[model samples]
Target: MRVFRILAVAFAAITSLSAAPASAQFFLKPADLSGPRVTGNEPGILGQTLTGATQTELDAALVWNLRAALNVAALQCRFAPSLFTREYYNSMLEDHAEELAKAYKTLGGYFERTSENKKQGVTAFDQYGTRLYSGFSTVGGQLSFCQVASDIGKEVLFSPRGSIDRIAHERMYELRRSLLAWGDQAYRGYFALAIPRLPNFNDDCWDESEYRAKRCGDFFASNDSKSG
Candidate 1:
C-alpha cells in the first residue's frame, strides 16, 4: 500500500490547487478522441460480447489493478457477471475516484500535464519493502490517480473479464490517444496566449509555434517581403 499512499498524497495536492485555470481548459468525450495515431501500444477496444465467462471465474483481466480497487469500493457499477462484482482486496483503487477527478480539475496545466506523457512505464515492487515508484504514467496525462477512475465507470459498462477486461483495455488505448489530443490542444492554446512575448518556439513549442522568428526566420522574412 506504500505506492497507494503516494496517490493519496497527490489527491491532497490536487485539492489545494482548486484555483487551476479554467479559461483554456477543455473537456473530452469519446467521439473527439478517435484520431490520434498511437504507434507503440496494443489496441484495447470495448463493446465486445463474451459468451462463456462465469461469475465465479477468478482470472484477472489484462492490467486493471485500478478498476479492481473501484470494484471493492462499489463506486463503479458492475455487470451481473463480472469478476469484479464481489469485493476483492487486489482490485481496489487506492483512493475514491470522483474526489480525485474533482481535485484534478483545478490543477491541470501545460507543465503538469506534459510531465506525465510516456509511451509506457512499469509498476512493481521489490522484496526489500522499499517503495520504488510513487506514481504511474501512461501515454496519456498522469493517470496515477482517480482521474482515470472516470474511465473506469465507462469501462465497466462492457466487461469481458473480471479484473482485466479486453474492451476496457481497448478503451484505455483510446483514452491515451484522446488525452494526448487534448494535451496537444491545451498546449496550442497555451502557446497562442504566450505568442506576444514568446514569438519563437524557444524549445517549448519547437514543433508547435506556427510563427517563430528564432526558428522560422526565413518563413517570417518571406511574409515580410510579401507585405512589402
Candidate 2:
C-alpha cells in the first residue's frame, strides 16, 4: 500500500512538472501602436509620399517598408542566436517572391511617373530603397526591433499568398513603434550595499611598512571610537 502511494505521488509530481510552461527570456508586449485601421492606402505611415500615390501604390509602399524593416532586423538581430530572423527572412523571400516583386515593380513605376526622366527616376528609386533600409537602423532599440520583427516574420510565413500587403498595413506602425528605446518595466527592489569601512590612510596612522597601532587606535577601529 505504501509503495503504491509513493508511486502515485511520484507520477503526480512528474505530471505537474510536465504541465508547467517552459520559461524563456521575457519581454513585455509593446503597446499597440498600429492606430485605427485603414485600407492599406496610408502613404504617410511608412514615410512615403504624402500625395500622388494611388491606393495600389500605397499598398506597395507599406509592403516594401515591412520588407525593409525585416531585412534590417535580420542583419542586426543575429546576436540573439535563437531568433529566426535571418532564416524567416530568407524563407519570406522565396515564399512571397511574387508579391514582393509586384510591390517593388509598382514602387519603381510610381517613382518613374513622378520623376523628370528615366535616369532621374532610377536615381530616385535607388535613393528610396537606401532610405527605406536606413530608416530601420537602430542602436538602443535593436533588441525590441529584432524581437518584434521576428514575430511579424513568423506570422508572414503563415499568411495567405498575395496578402503580404494586408500584414504590412496592419503591423507596420507597431514595427515603427518598436524602434523607440524601451527597457525592463518591472520594478526590482532597491538594494543598498553595506560596504566595509576602511581605516584612515593618514601618514600619522601608518609607519613606512605597517600600520601604527598607537596612532590608529585599533587596526580595525570601531565606528564609535573613530567618532569620539
Candidate 3:
C-alpha cells in the first residue's frame, strides 16, 4: 500500500508536464530512471500487442526494437555537442513529423509482414500501433541530451541537464531491455489468462495496465483500492 502510494505520487510528479509527443517516449520517471523495468520479472500481463505474437515472434520483435534503438537514429549519428541544443531536438521532431510518420508507416508495414504480426491477418500487434509508431521518438531526444552530456566532458552527475540526460539514457536503455524480457514471460493480465505472473514490484501494476477489467482488476489494482 505504501509503495503504491509512493509510486502514484512519483508518477504524478513525473507527469507534471502535460501530454505531448514524448510523454512516455524517451525518458522514464525517477523510479525507472535508475534501471531496467523488467529485471528479473516474469511474463504476467499480455496486452493487445502481444495477444497474437508467439514467444519467438515477440522475441524477434524485441530484438528489432532494441536494435532499432541502438543502431538507428541518434545511435548511428555522431553525438555532436551541437546536437544537444534543446532547439535542435524540438525543431527536428516538429519539422520532420510528416517524414517521420511516413517512415514509421513504412516500418509498420514491414513489421506487419513479419512472422509475429502476420500470423493470419495484421491483427497481432494492432493494439500496439500507437506505441510502435512513437516508441522510437524518444531515442532521438535522449541522444540529443546524451550528446550534450558527452560534450560537457563529465559524468551526467556533474550537472542538472547531464543528470537528466543520464537518467533518460538509463531509462531508454532499460526500456529496451524490458521489452526484450517481456517476451519471455508471456502473461497477459485482464485481457488474457494470468499464468506466469508479472514482477512483484510496485511499479509493474501501473505499467502493465490501468484500464478496468473484471478478471484481474483486484490483482492489478493497487493496494489503495480504496481510491477512486
Best by TM-score: 2
Which segments of candidate 3 are over 4 A away from where they belong?
A: 1-48, 75-133, 139-173, 176-228
Q: What would the per-residue lDDT of candidate 2 be over residues 1-228, giving only the tens digit for each residue?
A: 334533543465356456653211335434344555555555446665525878888888888888898899889988764555776687678778999999999988888988999889889899988888888998867767887897888788666678788888778877887786655544222232222445768788887868787877764566444344
TM-score of 2: 0.67
TM-score of 1: 0.27
Worst 10 residues of 3 by lDDT: 39-48
**In model 2, what lDDT does residue 35 have?**
57
| Model 2 per-residue lDDT at 165 | 85
Candidate 2: Cα lDDT at 196: 41
Candidate 1 differs from the real structure by a C-alpha RMSD in angstroms, to one decimal, of 16.4
Candidate 2 pairs with clashing backbones: none
Per-residue error (Å), model 2, residue 12:
31
What's the C-alpha lDDT at position 174 in model 1?
46
Location of the lowest summed lDDT over 10 successive residues in candidate 1: 120-129
Q: Give the alpha carbon lDDT tens digit for every residue of 8-64 in model 3.
A: 434543554343334322322221223443211224211224444444444344433
Model 1, stretches more than 4 Å misplaced? 1-31, 34-61, 65-149, 157-164, 177-228
lDDT of 1 by residue, 108-170 (tens): 221133334422111111210021011122223322112333345434433223323343334
TM-score of each: 0.27, 0.67, 0.27
